[model samples]
Target: MADFKLTYATMFNPPEELHAGFDKAVEKLKKNMGQEYTMLIDGKEVKADEKFDDHSPVNTDWVLAKMQKGNSKHAQDALTAARKAFPMWSHTPWQKRVELLRKAASLIEERIFDLGAAMALEVGKNRMESLGDVQETADLIYYSCYQMEKNDGYIVEMGKDPLVGYDARNVSVLRPYGVWLVVSPFNFPFALTGGPAGAALVAGNTLVIKPATDTAWIVRLLVDCFRDAGIPDGVVNFVTGPGSTLGQALVDSSEVDGVTFTGSFDVGMKMFQDFGKRNYVRPIILELGGKNPVVVSKNADLERATIGIIRSAFGLQGQKCSAASRVLVEDSVYDDLVGRLKETASKLVIGDPTDRNTYNGPVVNKSSYNDFKDFCEEINQGGGKFLVGGNVKTGGMFDKGYYCESTFVVDLPFSHRLWKHEMFLPITTIGRVKNMDEAMSIANDVNYGLTAGFYGSPEETEWFFDKIEAGVTYANRPQGATTGAWPGFQPFGGWKGSGSSGKNAGGHYYLPLYMHEQIRTLVK
Candidate 1:
């Protein structure tokens, strides 16, 4: 177990010890269910006037935790606390900041299994995916710390100004923005929340984290790691509630210096527009959802292509932003690849995610379950055929939760809007292309350029790389066609409408997004 490392790409073949630890942790966590949680502000347990029950997607009758229903006032209180702590946190030495953040990362790793169990129950991700999310969050924080140390705190000595009469010196320094807010999505809740939060804190910014309503329990546990790591009082705060009151309040506030939001395209775009209305333009980093695509060439390995497509299209119930929602196959092998994809998808077990045999689980909530039905109806109305699944599961345990079958649609015309929409469900649309050129044309036609996958010969792989418009691209890998991004290995982000900043997170350039540069000069 010591020699083995875990990543989304490598999670398929983990050590047996890993499974044993996860099972033990799940048993322990089950005994502590139905506990009440509170929001964290100024390092104190703050309770709201109203509260909401967080239910497990695996079974709706199970109340995982009772969470606070934060309002606009609570949002303002969190911002004020973070704003007040900014001076002390920003002034702390960079090395000290790194030390504390690293401690927090270590805490996350130490509690990986416990957090993983919470995530599986809350987000409806299978055991491996849930564990991978927890481990990835720790790695992301460690990566940011490594980046901070590698760059020597982002303070660089520059060349002296050319002046014969006087001695001159110049230096460049990157500094943090104040009161940064992180609004994370339900999918990969741990990584998305803690990744940005770690970057923000390690860069010397104070934080206020707001997680998705459906998955606040896991984020609260993550916040506990930071707080337990001895981050100064008020340096990091957590708030949970509906997006309309609490989330919008945090976004609309002029006090927030910057923000990192991960969610839908329309909501992100709306926030971008609202930020523009401020007195001065402020930094807003966004990772909107993606309608990712995968292209299969005629000469590609049909077996490898089918395996990769099925994994990427159906993993996490296909709710990932990088899910392969569109698969364009060359006309010669379209039928062959589609048959294999349907066969592989049909074998994925849909039940409680905590179970060892379960590969797929229920959708995150009732809203998503209803959306899946609506989207399937829309596809059928537009002359699309379901190659695999198109109905909701019922009877027994399925009726106890928000269970929906993994769906693959075919014969959907290119003219149909579903071809380009981001369904964010276990629903993928397949299309046939006459040639590689036609496939590339259709792949790059969408507004999203987040992640893409290709399977073909060496020369064709190079051509696919040259032609694809996505930020993250993979070629001929059975692991995942468009999914599985690690921190140092594959820095994940998007382009065009998929992301606000061009720089990908967990990469070389991501840590700097939380900072602004200043040049200092002295003459004698």
Candidate 2:
């Protein structure tokens, strides 16, 4: 197939003859395999007659192009290719695999802006957030490579234990989970998808990837980057379709040995139960949604506190799993901070995320917009008053877009479902607490414990550090600050529906876990 490049711009550009018309968006996405999108199986391009239309959320009228959609055939092909390549890939020299992963990392770094822009257009993330996501994704690649380079194939010994001073033998090894299925989400598509993909690939695992429809454009584009980095054919496959269909196709496949998924909790539980019920399952690592909390203290610096909350709570339009949807503030500073928060939030211009001036963007689609709307109605029904923005109204065609107004509800009852729920929208609920005891009570009340953000004096910060039931807790930080994975490290999943495994990603120490060990006794 001849090569062709596609460009997705951040700004609203008028379409050209070469571009497809988008009533809501410009031609921000185009997939070209021999001049148009075609699926790849073992490096061979195959066209599908049916197409999937991907939209850009920047404008409601712009209609992104319709590209060939994958079918059961694609899922089967990905599994087939992975099965065929598994033996060879798993047997590749550790050093060679490490080198390949490093190369993939470098290639991703070079295309950071290119991929980030695609996200801003197709995925509805602001430039800063998009840039952060792309970088975090690429960083995972490098992190996996570093892990691979340091892989200790295994361990064996004939020595001491409490009961046995003399032992016959001991051993350890990392065995690949044969064929891995990575199904990513609409939010943080790159980072969530990239973490598992990079780790599974560099660990000598052949894999299939199915990203959310809202953002598969970037997923496919990144696959190209992997190819440019010399990733072997069939070692990585990209597919997208109805989740239930595609998910069942891979999970039920006899050849698939593992699954990595990031999305909603209801779906996650279904996948988990199915894997168990089928009894034909492999390992499944999931990153489910959470009602993550952020706390503000009486002694905290309101300046730092406000910046943190705004970005964390509202960044990504509150679509982040780690987005600070719950807030517990000390009564001493509650009135003043909420007032100041109102001031800061009011200053934010909610509009197209692709624009340099855009601080907010439309949600992924109309459904997410309604989710925000319905929840706000519930809050208002429960006697909460809106301090800042509360209604959804768009002006002009651009205004007609799926823009959810920034919303904050005060005076919500602690018993309301909204307080404990994970609201992945622009709406946030801020509560006032009397002291440290009340603050801890508020923070620990939720079932979701993925992450926490706290602003206070060192001692006050320790209150959360000690009592907050979460995987991540940041003190004296902004809302959106310290929320993602950096290069050369790992970010783990949290308790109570966040994930099953302890190591979420970049546990480079576990390369041996995905490997096989052989032991032979030589008789003298």
Best by TM-score: 1
Error of 1 at 330 (Å): 0.4
lDDT of 2 by residue, 1-524 (tens): 01321211112232241122221122233332122455667877666767777767777555554555777878999899988988998899867877887787778767666666677877788766776677677777777777665544333543333344443443445567788888899988887888788888877789888888777777877788777878789988877777767667776676778778898888888888777765554677877888887788888898888878887778788898888888888898998989988998898887777666678888898888888778888888998989887777567745667887777789988888889887788888899988878878887876777888888898876666889888766887543532553444325567777766655565544344444556543322
Measured on C-alpha atoms, candidate 2 has an lDDT of: 0.73
Candidate 2: 10-residue stretch with minimal lDDT? 1-10
Model 1 has a clash total of: 0
Off by over 4 Å in 2: 1-36, 153-170, 479-482, 507-524
Please, what are the lDDT tens digits per residue for candidate 1 over residues 133-242?
Answer: 99999999999999999999999999988899998989999999899999999999999999999999999999999999999999999999999998999999999999
Each prediction's TM-score versus the true structure = 0.99, 0.88
Residue range with the least summed lDDT across 10 consecutive positions in model 1: 273-282
After superposing all C-alphas onto the true structure, candidate 1 shows an RMSD in angstroms of 0.8
lDDT of 1 at 297: 92
Which residue pairs clash within candidate 1? Answer: none
**In angstroms, how far off is 215's CA in candidate 1?**
0.7
